[model samples]
Target: MAAGVARSDDLRREPVLPPGFSLVTLRESGDAFGHAQAIAAEAGAATLVWVRRFDIVEFAVVLEPDAILAEARLAHYLAMNALADALAIHSPPERPLLFRWPDALTYDLGLIGGGRLAWPADCPENQVPDWLVFGAMVRATTMSPFQPGQTGVGMAEEGFEEVDAVDLIEAFARHLMLGVSRWQEEGAKPAARRWLDRLEKVTGVRHGIEPNGDLVATSQHGVERKGLVEALAKVDWLDRESGGPKL
Candidate 1:
């Protein structure tokens, strides 16, 4: 179910989003993605549902696209691209922010968080759905002592002194605008290349996204494919107990 939402009454200031975007702020425990999915029809396009918390940055954006859900799911890549740019805006020089496609964001190879997608349950892949939601969660601060062999990290602990949950959210919105414009002007190639650039460099390998949003890799051996739909169902980086990225 969608969680309850309010505006600036609970915030010092609302996120600075582009003109077409609106925000619904949720309390710490609220599920931004679920809420955005639930109210997509009425809330409409570019509605960003954000969970206010200091320990982790969590939010979801509502999208109303004309393409069928299968094709429209590529918006997930666009969201990740924007997120990469957002973190870069505040990251220390040379801090490597990496991504594992379909879903997973890492910093210096440690799991920080990633993204998720949700659409109408009854919507058919062949039909244009009412909306799609791309939700992202990033660990903002560590609340517990670090354990040996742990691979998760919070932004602050990694020298991201200038980044906070709210700041990153605002930056993401700004970059998303450029992503949309780039998609309009140059087609998917530009966005796909940007997303591809951040992955671990592999020699003799090439990557691309298919029209249906599959992750495709071509190498001297052969071509391999991964379905976006199936991949989205697996939350490999999520730590269910803490409701944050895996550690």
Candidate 2:
């Protein structure tokens, strides 16, 4: 999947991205997250890598956080919260938005899709990361040209209508900018709260994010903290057998 720089004689003609940002359009088959990470140091912050696809909104943004990687994991919450807000605006009001901790978004009870994050390999946990890429992909269309069950998974099978991927991406970009701006002005705690509000609010369970990006949940009976960094170490969203999203 090759990538091409968006061509515009005047930089002002670019998309109305966050205050200072640039766009890199990738082929539909390209991996936005992988490409963003590959060019993170050079592209710098606010460089958005996107795929122009009809079926799904696939893209990721590069961020230059001022906080250490340990604390900056909270940035994931910022992105997820922004995404949920954006989805809420464009999708059916009844379509539920819930997270599977660290990273994973579910529509109603069925798994739709979620976001993934990547940073420089050499960047230490205590050091402020030079660049970080938060990528996301949502299944918009069924993509089942023939038999629906044969594909194993399809958005239509999951019962989402009227929502397409391209519009979702545009809305998400706008919301993400707003969410990040809030993060800059306020603290991560408020951002975390906003994210928690969108997630499935489990009764009798209090949720919080640790400094190192781990997920903490306190139950009336006991408190348990799931390691976000560790959970991210494994790829849970994609199906190993089918090589796509799991049903």
lDDT per residue for candidate 1 within 1-247, as digits (tens), equals: 0111222342456778889999999887898888998899999999999988767789999888777887777888888999888987777768688888768998888888899988888999999989989999988766666789989887767777555566788899999888988877776667777888887657898888888889888999999998988988887878778788888
Q: Which candidate is the best by TM-score?
A: 1
The per-model lDDT (C-alpha) reads 0.82, 0.70
Model 2 C-alpha lDDT versus the unseen true structure = 0.70
**Model 2 weakest lDDT span, ten residues long:** 1-10
Clashing residue pairs, candidate 1?
none
Query: Which sections of candidate 2 miss by over 4 Å?
Result: 1-19, 145-163, 240-244
Backbone atom clashes (below 3 Å) for every candidate:
0, 0
Off by over 4 Å in 1: 1-11
